[model samples]
Structure formats: C-alpha cells, structure tokens
Target: MNYIKKTDAYDIYIEPSRKTIVIRQKWKYIWSVASGLPNWSYLEKKAWHQKADNVIWLQWGSHFVFWALVHDENNSNVSLHKKEFNLEFDIQWVTTDQHWTANVKKIGASEDFGSKVNPSDKKIYLAHTDVKRRIVSNINQNTVKHEFGHTIAVNDEYGKLNGNYYDPIYVNDTKALMNVGNELRARYIRDIKIKVNKMIPGVTFATFLDK
Candidate 1:
C-alpha cells in the first residue's frame, strides 16, 4: 500500500510485488484557427484523434504497459483506469496558413521543434508545425513516440551535450526511437525501462514484463 506523492512530474505508486503497472495519461489538444481552412471543429477533432493514435502506437511497441486516454474539450467522458504511473500532455496544432513566428508563444516556441516535458507542470508540449511536417513526411508516429519518451525521463539518443552524445550506446542505432526520425528499437525499450526503474521506487520493468 505504498503511495508516492504526485508532483508536476510523472510519478509511479505501486506495491513492491505488483506485477502489472498501468500508466495512465491525459491529453489536451489545442488548435489555432486559419482563414480559408476547413472547419475548426472538424480539423481540430481529426488532429486530436490522430495524436491519440500516434501515442497508442508508442505504447504498443514499448516495453511498459500504458493505458493512454486522449481527450479534447468535446469528448472528456472516456473511462480511464486508475494506474500507478501518469503523464499529462498539451498538444497544440498551428495551422500552416499562420506564420510560425506569429504563433510561437502558443507552439511552445523553442529553437528545436523537439517536444519537451515540463516536469514542473507534468505537461508535455508538441508543436503544431513539427507535427504537420512529420505527418507529411509519414513519420508522425515516430515523432510522437520520441516526444513521449521524454516524459519518462529518457534523454534524446541523438542529442549532444558539451560536444558529446547524450547516450553513446545509441549513437549508431539509426532505428532507435529516441534518435531523430527513427523507428522503435529494443534498446530504446530497455533504455526506457532503466529510466523508469530509477524514477519509481520498488517498481522494475522486469517485474512488469514477467507479468
């Protein structure tokens, strides 16, 4: 019956012997309006649902079990299981018709369009332009998974710090999800498990997988 205080960050609370750990995620989708575009209601709904689908793809291929429930302002009554780990995301969509600079504040305004997790607020932000680009390039799911990985404290596999790669282990792993535009890889799963184990006390990926 151990309980961990939930902060503005992802937190896990579980019994030492519990084999299955469910990660519950809540998502909020926002879209900016553009002139001459399709109806805002329809476009927003489609984008929001597509984001949910992309996140589900991540959960299905990852090592841990996640019960991700995404909701917009309209549909918020979906049943979500009570779980040990939880994450929240604010996904924003900026239409192509609007200038990027004009909407930077709403798009999370970073030099890198890479998504980030705000541990202080327990929220992840994904830029609209980044999403649209990935969608056009047919790599939306991969980008989605990469951003989600950051929520669990996983470092960018392709990122550099002080001229050194964050995780040299993944330097050559072109298919590592944490790497730029890469697919899911077993090593990425293992990396996530290691990070999660360190974050949550008495909960290990081994136990979850064994279940």
Candidate 2:
C-alpha cells in the first residue's frame, strides 16, 4: 500500500498505485557566520562562505531536534517535523554541504528579501541580519524549517507572485510557514507534488486548509 525510502537528506514515501509521494527530510546542519572583529560587515558583504562549526552542531542540533522529538505538539503550526503536506522530519548535525548547510550572515535578505536558497547549487543562503545566532536551525526548527521548504520545492506564498517583494498583499498571509508566518499548507508542497506526479503517473497529493 505504501513504501518508505530513507536517505541521509530525506525520507521518500511512495504509494505507487495511488500515485502519492510524500518526502520528509532528515536534515543535519552546520552554520557559517561572520565573526570577525570590526571588519565582520565587510567580510560578510564580500559573501565568504565559511566552513561549518562543530560546536554549533553539537549543542544546537541536540537541543532543537531531541527536544522536539520528545515533545508533543504545543502548536504544530510553528513546530518542525510537522506539515500539512503529509511531511515530517528528523534533523541531526553534520558538516557537509550535502546536508542543510547555511551561510548565516548579516547581509542580504534578512533586512528585506528574507531567506532564500541558491537554486543552482541547492544551498541555503539564510539571512541573519536580525538575531544574534541560531545554529541547529533545521528539521523541526521553525526558522530553518521554513527555509528548508524552499530546498525541497516549496514556493513563497507571500508577495513574490502578487507583485514585488515589497508588496504587503500577502503580509497578512504570514500564518503559513512558507509565508512569513508559522503554518504549512498544500501549496508548500506544490513543486514536489508535481515532480512526484511526473515520476509516477496519476499520483495525486490531497489538498488541505488551515484550521
């Protein structure tokens, strides 16, 4: 009736006859930040991609993931490993680009564009121009989880399509994780659903609405 395939990056679910595919990721993350002296900004703008931090992997990863795994849904809307698309996740720590590697910098997006993935390389370019730090920010983690949605083919439900990124038309739509909010929806799984449907003819992803 259903088949599940696990990998280092994601778990693939396939119901061939029914043509339904659900992909849940188990992301291990390592972050690179600009920690230089007064020149942190200059270095950050230069856009240097630093190597992952080992200590961050140890502390942040364990705390965020392990705690989420043990806890129940206080509010699944903002939680990681839970989604409206029949998706869930498990995150650990790793120092590889193949994993959820982020360039946490005080440049780009954070001030405006928000976070985005480099489509060519499939790497996360997280904008940290806001908070001090949040490594171990993947899987069930809200911030990282939102960005991860992009990597696995989730689209921005915010302003991009309606107009420019500056448009506030969808600002109020931020309750969904893909938006600037904390929820997940069928549209978040749109791209992946298409890909899956292509692979297995007639596979349909059921749609759902928020409660």
Candidate 3:
C-alpha cells in the first residue's frame, strides 16, 4: 500500500495486491461559529463551545473534538468478485452523544424512516427509535449508519434509479449500508474516488463499476 494524500479529514492510500484505493476518513466533528459573545463551555453538557444549536463552519477534522472511534470494517475494502476494482469507505467514527461534524438530527418515532435529505445534503434525519439504543451503547444501528452513508455522498441502492448508481449488477441487496444493509458494495465508494482524484493531480483510479 502506497500513501497518496493526507488531510485533516481523510487519508488516501493505494493497495496494489487487491487493486484497491483506500480512504481513511477521520470521524471528528469540527464546529465553529464566529460570535460576538465569548466562547462558552457548557458545564452541564459534555460538548463545550461558543454555545448554539447551529454553526456557521462545520467540517471534518482530527484534532479538535476527541471522541472514541467506531469502525465499520464491514464496508471498507474492495470486493473479491470477478476481479472488480472499486473504492470503499473505511470510516472511523468518533463516539459521542453529540456529533458536531455531522448534521444529524433526531426525529419522532412516527416518522416513516431515517433519511438523508438529499444526495449532497449534509443533514441526516433519523427516527428517535433508531437512535435510542445507540445513545448509551455507543453502537450505531443500521438505520443511523445508512443515513451516515449519505453524508459522504453515496446514493441509495434499493430503487431502480439508485441500484444502478453504485452496484449496477446487484439484485435486492439488503446487507449493505445504503441498501438498508450493513455490508458495503464496491461501487459505493465512487464519489469518494472522484473526490480523491480531483484533489490529487496526475492521479486517476478507474471505478470498475463504471466500466
């Protein structure tokens, strides 16, 4: 594996034996808002900052917020089927009740399902039931993780329009992160690959699914 790029939010590496490109994205939530008021550390809460529900600057970084990382190893490597090479997400989630980096909000149990507002939307709306057990357990449920997939730009794969978006050859795949499953498919990492290529000049990796 050859290291390609490194940033506060992610790191890139190329693994030749498996013909896979790796992206290790840091799961820290950086929340900062310029305020006329002084930075406030809410003693009542574990999260301390300038004090507000909203933030003007929110991004992924490793230094600021210290939260335990939860790994989704189920979805972090290229599949071994048909010699197909594709990108995959090796996400490291920092554990905490509050994720200032993600625009995740809790909705009522009456809601039909958890959803990411849009393809490029950073916000995620998850039903309260999906998050209740995860609060203290530190183990994220499938619903919560599925919505998290959207924040990184992976589209849904259940419908006719979406299945072809990533895993074009997949059928009723229910065990992957975006397809209401926990196991990730190869093409799910397309967006991340595109982003990486754009960031590093003279470097391009083909996503086998696109071929």
Candidate 4:
C-alpha cells in the first residue's frame, strides 16, 4: 500500500489530500529513528544549508517519535550546546526495511526535499525503517548528506547531472563523512563548498564560525 509518485527531480511531495498521513510546517514533528549520539546539533549550526531551502532528519521510527514529543521547544532540550540556533527539522520515519530501497534510501530517512530561501518553510520528509543496524560516523554522514541532497531536490540519479560533480562513488567508505581522516572527507567538503558557492556566493563558514 506504499504508493510513490515521483515529483520533479529529487523532490517527492506527498499530497495531503491523497494520503491519511500529512506533514506540515510550523508543527513540532518527530521520527522513529535512533540517534547514536545526542544533540544532533551538528546539523543545526552547520554551513551546509547555505543553498538549500529545507532540510529533513530521517531516522528510525521510535527515535523520531521520541524526539518529536520530547525536545522540540526552541530545539534546546535536544542539544547540550549553550548557544542554540533557530533550527527545527520536519522529522519523518521510514518504519520498515522495505521502504529503504528507494533511489536514495537511508536508515529511516532520505534527504529528498528543498528550501527556496534561507529558513525556507517548505517541507521535506525523510524516510527510514524500524530496522536496527550499526551505523558508524562516516557511513552515517554519507547517508545523511545523500538524503539531504534529495531534500534539496537534487537528483538521486547521478547520471542526469555532471558525472564529475555529484559522484556517488565519493560517498563510499573512505570518501564518506564518517571517514573523517580520509581524502574523501576533504573531497566532500569541497563538494559542499561548491554547492555553497552557488547558494551563498562568496560566503564561507570561516567568516561565520569554525568547523
């Protein structure tokens, strides 16, 4: 009973009129995924969103649901950091193992939506399953960004874009975010920088905060 109708590019918009489930902005939401470490603050203040309009946090169902109910006010209780950013993620969950088979599936979420402007209220739903598995840092970050790319309505199908640019190969193992010491991490940073160049022009994270 899972009906997936592809929208434009990486954007998968589910019409609320068609399905019983509806996710809207301006509401505190949650997913059912597990967060290995607390304070998903890494995403909140990061310079990663200079170009994107919306971002979604997809994970296991339990994790999503728990976070949604517990720590959404000012996104403060959720983080240990003293200074909090004006951040909120429209959380969603995958709920089953099968749902993870999409073109850019992760544990319970896909980075498959976009924001037209900074703090864009446009929504993106991350999908993930209830299944549990070990997710190391590099693997986790790759999955996170890949799906985040989807959230920005970027193409999941690599062939459509410049092969030299959005290479999925860079997301594998050493080239992943979890593999911090690897050259791929350097490459990933460069890729994000290129995206920022398009989004914010000459702005750099160094101008705002340290990494």
Candidate 3 per-residue lDDT over residues 1-211, each given as its tens digit: 3447665444666554655555555443332223342332434122321111111011111112111112333533223222333344454545543222443333333434434434332333433344222322322334555554565566666555423355444547755546644565556555566565554233344443331
lDDT of 2 by residue, 25-125 (tens): 43333344444523345455333222122222221222211111213345332332222233333333345435445555544333343556664554666
Model 1, clash count? 1
lDDT values of the candidates?
Answer: 0.44, 0.44, 0.42, 0.27
Model 4 steric clash total: 33
Task: For residues 1-211, write the lDDT of model 1, one tens digit per residue.
Answer: 4434333323344332352333334444444533444444666667655764456444443344533232332433222222333222322233432111112112333334545655444455555543433542323344555666665556777656447667776766644667665554444345334444554433333423211
- Pitting candidate 2 against candidate 3, the one with the higher lDDT is 2
Q: Estimated TM-score per prediction?
A: 0.48, 0.46, 0.41, 0.23
Which one wins by TM-score: 2 or 3? 2
Alpha-carbon RMSD, candidate 4: 17.6
Task: Write candidate 4's Cα lDDT for 68-90 as tens digits.
Answer: 12223454333322221111133
Query: Who wins the lDDT comparison?
Result: 1
> Could you tell me the lDDT of residue 8 within candidate 2?
38
For model 4, the stretches where C-alpha displacement exceeds 4 angstroms are: 1-125, 128-146, 149-184, 191-211
